[model samples]
Target: MAEVSAEARIEAPAEKVWAQLTDFTAYGEWNATHTSFPNGGPDTLETGATFVENMKLMGFPAEVTWTVEELETTRVLAIRGKGPMGVNVGTRYALAADGAATTVRIDGEFTGAAVSLMAGKLKDSATAALNESLRKLAGLVT
Candidate 1:
């Protein structure tokens, strides 16, 4: 299993950050891992919602069917999905508010038979992607 996380402090309120973070229409613009949602982003972000997403990881394009695991309007959104080669992936977006700024954190996990083969490379690349995603999210909301 491999786990990675990245964080950023955005000069904006949690409401603003969460709004952009969950904005499906503009998700591809700031979401590094997302290439496209074939049917479009989820109509709703509530728990139990499912969506199919096209993504690039480890230099390969994959289609993942994800289910919303958790949701808190301005606090957190987490999803779990199955990826290519029987890999189980989970990602969480966490938001913390302090005065006028929001602290955003992205957490990722990969598990299953395939993850052991390239854990190191996956960790490195995933960390970079998480950081880059945070940067893009910050740019959009702040």
Candidate 2:
């Protein structure tokens, strides 16, 4: 398994950050790995809602079927998905409000047989993607 995380302090309120984070229509603007949502974004942003997302990582494209696992307004959102080659993917977005700023953290995990073959590279790529995503997200909200 591979685990990666990135955190950034955005100069905006949690609500503002959360709004941009959940705006799937604009996801590609900030999410580095995102390519498109083939069937549109999740119909609803609640637990058990499912969506199909197309993504590119390390020059390879993949489609993932994701199910929202948890949701906490303006605080946390977590999803688990099945990716190409039997890889299991999980991502969690956590927000902590601090006065006028919000600290956002993204945690991701990759598992299954495919991950074992290139765990190091996957971790590095994923970490970079998360960091870039956060930077773009901050640009939009702050």
Candidate 3:
């Protein structure tokens, strides 16, 4: 299994950051690994809702079918998915309000036979992607 995480502080309130984060239609604009949502983003932001996303990581393209596992307006969003080669992927976006600004953290995990073979490289790539994604997200709201 491979796990990666990144955190950043944005010069905007939690609500502002949450708005941009949940705006799935604009997801690829800032999410580094995102390619596109083939059938469009999820129609609802509730637990159990599912969506399909196309993404690129480690120079390879993949399609994932994701189910929302958790949701809390302006605070958290978590999803788990099945990716190519039977890889299981999980991601969580958490937000904390701090006065006039907000701190955001993204945590991701990968597990499956394929991951065991390239865990190190996957960790490095995923960590970088998360950081880049956070930077772009901050740019949009801050």
Candidate 4:
């Protein structure tokens, strides 16, 4: 298994940050790993809601089937998914409101036979992607 996390403090309220985070239509503009959402971002982001997303990791394109496992408006959102080669992936976005700013943390994990083979490199790539994503997200909202 491989785990990666990144965080940023954005100069915007949690409401504004959450609004941009949940807006699938604008995701590609800020999300580093997101290449496209073939079925479009979920219309309703709730538990059990499922969607397919096209992504690029380590320069390889992959299709991931994701299900929303948890959602709390302006606070938290988590998703678990399956990708190629029997890989299992989980991602969690947590937000904390401090006065007028929002602190966002992204946590990601991967577990599978394939993941074990490239865990180190995957961790490095994912960490960088998460950091870049947070930077872009901050730019968009703040």
- lDDT of every model, 2 decimals: 0.92, 0.98, 0.97, 0.96
For candidate 1, the lDDT comes to 0.92
Q: After superposition, how far is residue 21 of candidate 3 from its true place, in Å?
A: 0.4
Stretches > 4 Å off in candidate 3:
none
- Candidate 4 local distance difference test against the native: 0.96
Best by lDDT: 2
Lowest summed lDDT over 10 consecutive residues: which window, candidate 4? 39-48
lDDT of 4 by residue, 1-142 (tens): 9999999999999999999999999999899999999989887899999999999999999999999999999999999999999999999999999899999999999999999999999999999999999999999998
Model 2's C-alpha root-mean-square deviation from the true structure amounts to: 0.4
**Mind giving the per-residue lDDT tens digits that candidate 2 earns over 3-105?**
9999999999999999999999999999999999999999989999999999999989999999999999999999999999999999999999999999999
Among residues 3 or more apart in sequence or in different chains, the pairs in candidate 3 whose N, CA or C atoms overlap within 3 Å are none
Q: For model 1, how does the per-residue alpha-carbon lDDT over 1-142 read when each residue is reduced to its tens digit?
A: 9999999999999999999998898999898878999998888789999999999977879898899999988999999999889998999999999889999999999998989999999999899989999999999988
lDDT, candidate 1, residue 6? 98
* TM-score for each predicted model, relative to the true structure: 0.97, 0.99, 0.99, 0.99
Candidate 3 residue-wise lDDT, 49-119, digit = tens: 99999999999999999999999999999999999999999999999999999999999999999999999
Segments of candidate 2 deviating more than 4 angstroms: none
Candidate 1 or 2, higher lDDT? 2
Question: Can you give the lDDT of residue 51 in candidate 2?
Answer: 99
